[model samples]
Target chain A: MLEVLAERFNYAVIIVLMMVGLYAVIATGNLVKRLVGLSIFQTSVFLLYISVSKVFGGAPPIFDYKDLAYDKLDPNAIYSNPLPHVLILTAIVVGVATLSVGLALVVRIREAYGSIEDDTLAEADYSLELEKGV
Target chain B: MSASDITQYFDYIFMAMLLCIGIAVIRLRNLFAVVMLTGAYSLISAAWFVSLDAVDVGFTEAAVGAGISTVLLLGAMLLTSREADKTSLGRHAAAAVVTIAAGAGLFYALGDMPVYGDAASPANTGVGMEYVDLTAEQIVIPNVVTAVLASYRGFDTMGEVFVVFAAGLGVALLIGLGGSKREED
Candidate 1:
């Protein structure tokens, strides 16, 4: 049981981080806080992919040409999976792009509604609806 | 102890730090502190990435996560309020319930996962190995990650660039490029 726990502990940490992010997104009323939660969530997923790509006794995915000549390359030379790293490189860029857009929307919300809190904005909308009905 | 043992200990330390940061981000009411903690969280995660043999990913994470994201969040903070309003108990309870349920489900699935750093795991074999083996002959690049990212997956990278462009366009269209220029006009 202890060995299993040790082996799978990375996933366990990731899941906890993910849960914290999700809770923040759901529970926080502040728009900026929600975006922070979203970022935390996105980052946890990044960690997960990188963690999955790790190989024991492996080097980083950079080839040492002197030690690993093209003609006499060792097939047993271990490297962490580069495919996931490639995927995550794009993901980190996309994550930032998404974050910038989200922040822009939050700024726009504050400007238009005069409040960034979800509850305050909802209450204002409700009052506006009541005024229109009367 | 062996090197792997030390690496494992480092992983544990990083994970514990991340957990503490995550909880702090959640419990803190001050937005400035939260933003700073988020950047620290990213930097620590980047360090963890390096230990995991993902140098390129770590480099990118440090630049984008800790640097750009923190700046962007600070800019947004300037436009918005600093303190988050108190959330009600009921809402907190509901979110906790949902998060716990989701976490339990994922935890149950974790049993079937390959042990950490098992080289023969499915993710490390097959196509990943193929890229590692082929890069020397095909791309002649020292960095297998660079070779695969720029060559084998060039189209994907192009698509990602387009996505980033679209996001920038969206932000500009929504709020303009910076300063009071858009507001003044």
Candidate 2:
């Protein structure tokens, strides 16, 4: 069963991590916790991509001729796709940029409301909207 | 079951997981949780893409779906409320039902999709073959995924970056700039 699970483990883990992140986002009222959930959720995708790139018996794409012990490339060798790894590298950078900007905004929201609870913030916004008569 | 049989049944498992995660994402009441579930849904879909051997597409989807989208969603949620009016649940339920129905219909409609790596697929038969055949010699990138995404799909990537920039700008505008404080009247 473990081996079977391992065969599709990448998909399984991705789904589980997603649910965990989802639960955090749904259950937690704290803004920072929500952000953390969001980060976890995103990181799971990174794992998914990395997992997908693995071929059944593939070796890394690196090619080095200095080692005389190393044989030449075998035409039938199954090399795990390296494209996904490169893509995820770009994505991780983008995710970091987005997270930093988001955290900065959360700080501003906290400053404005003096609290991060959704209800309190909503009430404050409603009152402001009411006063403005928009 | 033999190894091939196991691989065959993996498809059903992936589909079931996708459905379950999708439902959870919609059914969950917490806005933050919903966003997180949405990320899960994306990861599941990315796995499906990998199963199809669209490794490059899967990578792009996994990153955008799970990473950038989640952060942007949480940013939007932060400026808003997680606890919505209880009265809105009925409408939300209706929306959920409609969404599921439409999604199911779409899935059913695609029953004729070519099998993964089928010889007739455009990626297998046409100029794509030239791409696959010539990648090592022409690009010297070693990784076909990189060659396709960075070189062949460069224009699309530039557009994707622009979209991300636009989304960040929109969020900034919605939340305001430099943390200006409003005076209490």
Candidate 3:
């Protein structure tokens, strides 16, 4: 157990960050702050993937074509795993786009309700519903 | 301690900074400062990613996470309240419970994960190496990550581009361009 803890301590720390993000998303009434929490959570996952790709004494995934011929590729050459990097590239773009749209929606919500706090927005919504009922 | 040991300590320092920043983001009531701290947090994360030899991922994180996202958050902050309301103590207690429980559960699950940076770890030994090995012959790109993203995962990348486009459209529809003649009229 001690050995496992020592080896994977990084992951435990990252998971703690993930939880902090999760808490912010759920607990914060400010919509933009919630999005910040969402960003933190997404980033923690990205770090986990990057951590998984690390290779001891490995160079970056970029190949230096000037140094070595493609045909005579060195079998023993070490490079950090590139697959996770590729996967996360697309994800990062999507994250930014999603955040932009979320912000725009927050702008619209503020325009509608005169407040961006989730609780205040919900109160406005419930009052609208009550007015219709009465 | 050797150079590698020193680097490991740097990692520890970065991780500690990340933890402190995360707590600060949650505890602070000032929305603008929280957004700025989030940007700083992501920049540190990019530094960590670069240290892990994920230069491409780090680059993307710096551009998207710290750059574009911060600008968007700031623009939104311009339209929203600057400070968040304080929640009840009961809500704080509930949030703390939920966060600690989730963290403990994930920590327990970490015991089964492959040790960090092990060359033979499943993530490295699987299709990961095949991409590295074949990128030279098949794609001829200096960056294997770029080759795989453009050639091997063309469909997924295209979908992501379309998603970005759609998101832009959605934002434009929701919040019209302020300087546009259509909005001015």
Residue-by-residue lDDT tens digits, candidate 3, A63-108: 7776445365677889989999998878988989999999999999
The best-first sequence of candidates by DockQ reads 1, 3, 2
lDDT of 1 by residue, B1-185 (tens): 11253577799899999999999999999999999999999999999999999999999999999999999999899999999999999999999999999999998888788778888888788798899888988887789998888899999888999999999999989987767797888
Looking at model 2, residue B60 earns an lDDT score of: 68
| Candidate 3 residue-wise lDDT, B1-185, digit = tens | 11132345657988999999999999999998999999999999999988888888888889888998998898899888899989778877888898888888888788789887678888789998899988887887788998889899899899999999999888889887665867667
Per-residue lDDT over B4-108 for candidate 2, one digit per residue giving the tens place of the 0 to 100 score: 323335556666776576556434556677667767766766676565454565666678767776666776666655643332455445544654554455344
Poorest 10 consecutive residues by lDDT, candidate 2 chain B:
B114-123
Q: What is the lDDT of residue A84 in candidate 1?
A: 91
Candidate 1 positional error at B159, Å: 0.5
- The local lDDT score (0 to 100) that residue A79 gets in candidate 2 is 43
**Candidate 1 lDDT (Cα, 0 to 1):** 0.90
Evaluate candidate 2 and give its CAPRI docking class based on DockQ: incorrect
Clashes of each: 0, 3, 0
Docking class of 3: medium
Q: Tell me, what's the RMSD of every candidate?
A: 2.1, 8.6, 2.2
